[model samples]
Target: MEFFTEYGEASQYQIEEIIGRGSFGVVAAAVDTQTGERVAIKKIHDMFEHASDGTRILWEIKLLRLLRHPNIVEIKHILLPPARREFRDIYVVFELMESDLQKVMQVNENLTAGHHRYFLYQLLHALKYIHAANVFHRDLKPSNILVNSNCKLKICDFGLARASRDDPPLAIFWTDYVATRWYRAPELCGSFFFKYTPAIDIWSIGCIFAEVLTRKPLFPGTNVKHQLDLITDVLGTPSHETLSQIRNEKARRYLTGMKRKHPIPFPSMFCNADPQAVRLLERLLAFDPKDRPTAEERL
Candidate 1:
């Protein structure tokens, strides 16, 4: 029978209201009594009775405790008191943001070239930080991005994540479960992505970049086949001639095996943006994840 105060003092942490709800938790706006600061508290469903999912939720604390960055959601404390919901006893404290990108996108004024640059730059900074920590977001969608009161964006979500630095890329770590369907890379939906390099993260980044530009998903694929189809539809199918240089048959399989189609860029979504940004999207959304741009090159 644990209590909130015994756990820590979020009483000073006034949870105002719910701002966001996810698969396993709800995020609310909170204010700190000690520092007179604003924050967000993510209350993960506590299912102490159910060990597997519960343990995984608890692991969020371990991962959050290890990471620190301006772009990634900042963690302040872990609520260790009485279990809540299905989670045994889990409450992860975070800095409250004014809202998430999803809600922000609803506003008309923020949808333009200028805001796009700022949004993308911030996302890059967050991804750079996660990669430096050797952690892959696995999920990188606009919905997962949140905006602080000052309009700074941060990346969130670590579930469905795996650490590859400790293991060689032997087999798929449940491919179907990796990342969101739309933002998922070619290899993720079909083949292996370069023995598990952080490059896959960049692939996800490319997808995200494409989405932000058009205000629509780069590859809004419903499944494995559709995923490839959506990509080829935009970038056009890769000719064996273009990929004849690829030695590994498995590596070539992604584009070759799938039915290629003509690419249709969605310029209608954006009014006035740099052609360079468009060019960059084409490169990032390549059929082959290997052909995707490096973070340095992107910058």
Candidate 2:
């Protein structure tokens, strides 16, 4: 497939085929003619059309350059625009990967316990590195996790990621839809908490692991309220102290008015999963963010 638009730098790479497409743009697998190495070129079309999209692109590029790790996808190059023409589109080159975890989970069912352990290990290791740098990948989902056939994994898409601050309010100064709803933490379900921490990412990792084990989304909520309901259904109602942490008076009242829920045993919910794995999952999915383990601790 041909690129939607041409770039002078793209002439050096032999476009093999279109690999993927998303709301932002199209990704094409290509080979560097000079080095014979493969790469994935993402052409974000009309980047400036939406201010938020443009800002996200710049933020992602800046973060990728700052945070370098084996488990993080690397940006090889950014194709320069023409000298005189107004810049509208951008092409970014990244290391090629066979597929993302989302596709793998959908098509492959033979994943063993070893595979699950290794995947979780790599994810935690990557998160530990990012957290150490005071960076939080607000969006951590299967689609953002790229994997190779050799069992290698790398985290991608830092568009929604944010750098942590000493001030909790500034650190959590983000919109309610910070992450994909399926993997979002309860604290973010309806702005229940006044602040958020790296534990949000840990909760996301737990949700991802649950999907890896069951080959399905753990909390596939249809709406915000439904999402919280799905979470409470599995983990039960939050404790009074935890509920007290809710800064949103309306949200707190909503929960207080609801029928109390009893926690479902993870082993009962994930019957085929290993007991040891379920034990770890329970701690990861704790209602209170503080109760969750840090990526470094888990690693």
TM-score of each: 0.81, 0.97
lDDT of 1: 0.67
- Lowest summed lDDT over 10 consecutive residues: which window, candidate 2? 1-10
How well does candidate 2 match the true structure in TM-score terms? 0.97
Per-residue CA lDDT of model 1 for 158-246, tens digit only, reads: 66555556544544353446777888876666544335556677877777766666556657777777886766776778766656745
| lDDT at position 60, candidate 2 | 98
Quote the lDDT for 182 in model 1: 83
Highest lDDT: give the candidate number: 2
Cα lDDT tens digits, model 2, 37-81, are: 999999999898999999899999999999999999999989887
